[model samples]
Target: MEALLKEAPKVNHHLDHMPNMLVCENLQKVYPTPTGDYVVLDDLQLEIKQSEFVSIIGHSGCGKSTLLTMIAGLNEISGGTIYVDGEPVREAGPDRAVVFQSPSLLPWLTALQNVLIGVKQVFPSASKAEKLEICKYYLDKVGLGNDFHKKATELSQGMQQRVGIARAFALKPKILLLDEPFGMLDSLTRGELQDVLLEIWQKEKITAVAITHDVDESIFLADRVIMMTSGPYAKIGDELVIPFARPRNRKEVLEHPEYYDYRAYLLNFLNH
Candidate 1:
């Protein structure tokens, strides 16, 4: 862990020079309702550099997940553009992969098969052996090596999400979009998964955006925590640059003075 923590500075320094992996400019989204058009997000601008971990937090209806869906191209934009690696994102593709709040796994498929479904979709040209290898590698990386043959119904909620994480990583995407992926778990399980995710992000250096309401989770996982105002036309309210060094220990993070300050500031922002 010490060595990993020491390496973070170098990784961050390298990220400073890399191009933006994801960019949203004047973004907007709206839905046509029975009476009128509902504006969910408007004039929202965000830029995420390569290898950065950023989390967005807000009230339930504040469009946090809506923004993520736009970036993933799962939702349409009423205005502006979203670019991934210099290309405009108009549809869902392998470049951006999303892990939703629910595990959303196929109950009948074994964990290994579930991940392979994505691997095959993204890398259809790979041989069967290669696909299997890719699936197993990520499953093992997420501490699920022994559960590969287990069906989704047989796994715990946490274990199922590990499969979801493995499936997303197996795609080797340019941007990872997570929408409250850990929100359903107990505190202990959520913390465990957070550590697993951090370890993978550190090694892979994939640009990541997560939507989470947990203040501690935001502080621990993100390079920057972006807070949003309440909807119906929500934009970025403020962004806090997390200063804690990585491989951040939960106990150490809680002990740091700025952690509490950050927590209090976020809580106040949300409650205001």
Candidate 2:
């Protein structure tokens, strides 16, 4: 067990020379109400390496999603700064793609068309043939090859979310931000998508940060789990390195003893 635990830190050692793919320093978020300013997050610092999958988990009001939005450059930061691939992020760009909790698909467009819209926007310089190939590839990658002609209104909720995933990956962003993208799926569907996502993360090695409420999901998906304290002025309280090797199987992960230990620790942290 101790040997298994040593593997994650070893991975970090080789990445010391690589510049961080994402960095958040002394991050702060505040919202103004009629009465006074409400502090949601303060003095938070986080760094994610190239291709690392990290999950942030905390209580409902801990500003987890808010932090993701700031990194995406969709929301203004009250203080501190965010850097992606060594460049400071000031606005949304093609370099980053985000998938939110609700599958925000254009209801009128077919799955292929929906993905093409994003691909064309992000890769406008590419030839039309190239863009069409990209759209087809990601939609197939998400197991939606047969449903390419279906619109959002004709698809199940799970299938709609798959379209969302395909659209995000079609952009070929260097970083992917997920704000509880699987929160609404059933357990079986969630597990299927988790494996699909992990396969893509392994193949592409894109830096990913996800905000999740499920402890088991974090253990299954992340290289490290960052836990936040209860709000107001919530910050990273603790973190656990998930030492399980990649190409991870759900059954194998469940059989591992340390998985339960990590689960217990996270449950305790959130409960207290």
Candidate 3:
């Protein structure tokens, strides 16, 4: 553990020159209770470099989702500031798109239409055909090529999520926030979409932050895994840099020499 901590700085050395896409400084979340204020996150500081993919993990109710929503500007921040591209995050904007566990697609909308909801907002000036092209391209990328015209109500849960992911990417957001986007999916489907996300992320090069309970999914998708301590007042517990190279193969990652050691460290942190 000591050696790993010492070596952590080397992992992001490649990203050193890039500017920070998201910066959370002295961040906090609190709710005013009748009796007293309830605090969730406190003094949580994080710096995500441009185009970086980071996964955050912790036990339930540890402010994992809270933190994500705060960054999304969907939740109020009690203290500190969050910035994207050095601009303070004040409210939800086109620059950041979120994929929740539930796709929450309107039943009347087709898969393509569901995605166009955000696409139109982000690229209103583009021609109708150009918007359709962008939407269809992402849907196909997520393996929803044939279901473009299908209603959100008609698609399976997994398929609905594909639409959600397609929607997020189609908007061309500079930052993507994923709140357990695959939580409702079965293991097999979840694994497939994880790969799909990686593929899209690779091509788009958007900065992303994902909150997941699955540790393997964390290691497989993230360049670095940030673990949080249990909350009433949660903060960054520790972070581990994934040693595997990008465009990773699942099998290769699972078989890497350091896989189990890294896995053990994450598991140990969660356990304690």
Candidate 4:
């Protein structure tokens, strides 16, 4: 394990070089149900650097989704602030694109049309050919080239999720937010999508924040895995650094001596 740690590359290279792309300061979220006020998150603070990929994990109902929504500016913060590139996040904008667990595609629109919507919205000044090229490039990147004309409802769950990913990447947002985007897929399909996501992220170099429950997935994808505690009031419990080199492979990573130690450390943290 010590030898593997020595061999592993530095974990925070992107953070050291890139400017802060997103910052959350003492973030909190409260809900007013019919019964009373409920606190979902408490004093949650996080930072994501430009071109960094961060994965957040915790027990169910740990406010993981709530935190992502708040960062995406889809949900209002109860009391705190989120800044994207030094400016406060006031509402949803093209600068931040999100891919939800359900894919959230418009059933009425074809996959090509769905991607075109994001391209048109983000690059209205560009010519029609430019928009079409962007849409086609992303759809093909996500392994949806042959199905571009298919409607959302006609595609499988995994295919629909691919469209969602392609659309989010097509927008070329300053930050990409994912809320358990692969949680519903089977193991084989999920692994395939993860690889595709990594390829796209490396190509685009976009900042990203992903909320997931899978420990191995987090370790494989993120430079750092931020773990939160279960909530009525959830907060960050630990941050695990993944020192594995880029262009990682699941088989090779598992064979490394440090893999078990790192996995065990996170498992202990989560189980405790």
TM-score of 4: 0.94
For model 3 the local lDDT of residue 58 reads: 99
TM-score of 3: 0.97
Off by over 4 Å in 4: 1-11
The TM-score obtained by model 1 is 0.93
Tell me, what's the RMSD of every candidate?
4.9, 2.2, 1.2, 2.3
What lDDT would each prediction earn against the true structure? Answer: 0.89, 0.88, 0.91, 0.90
State every prediction's TM-score relative to the real structure: 0.93, 0.94, 0.97, 0.94
Which should have the higher TM-score, number 1 or number 4?
A: 4
lDDT of 2 at 197: 87
Q: Once model 3 is optimally superposed onto the true structure by TM-score, how far is the C-alpha of residue 14 displaced, in angstroms?
A: 1.7
C-alpha lDDT (0 to 100) for residue 23 of candidate 1: 90
* Top TM-score prediction, candidate number: 3
**Candidate 1: minimum summed lDDT over ten consecutive residues — where?**
1-10
lDDT of 2: 0.88
- Candidate 3 per-residue lDDT over residues 153-267, each given as its tens digit: 9999999998899988988989999999999999999999999999889898899999999999999999889999999999999898886888988999999987887888899
Model 2 lDDT tens row, 1-272: 34544533534554567678999988999999999999999999999999788999998988999999999989999999888988888998767899889998999999999999999898889999999899899889899869999888899888988888888888889899999999999999999999888887788878899999999999999888999998999999988778788888999999997777778878878988
What is the per-residue lDDT of model 4 for residues 34-53, given as tens digits with 9 covering 90 to 100?
99989999998888888888
Which runs in model 2 stand beyond 4 Å of their true positions? 1-11
Q: In candidate 1, which residue ranges exceed 4 Å CA deviation?
A: 1-14
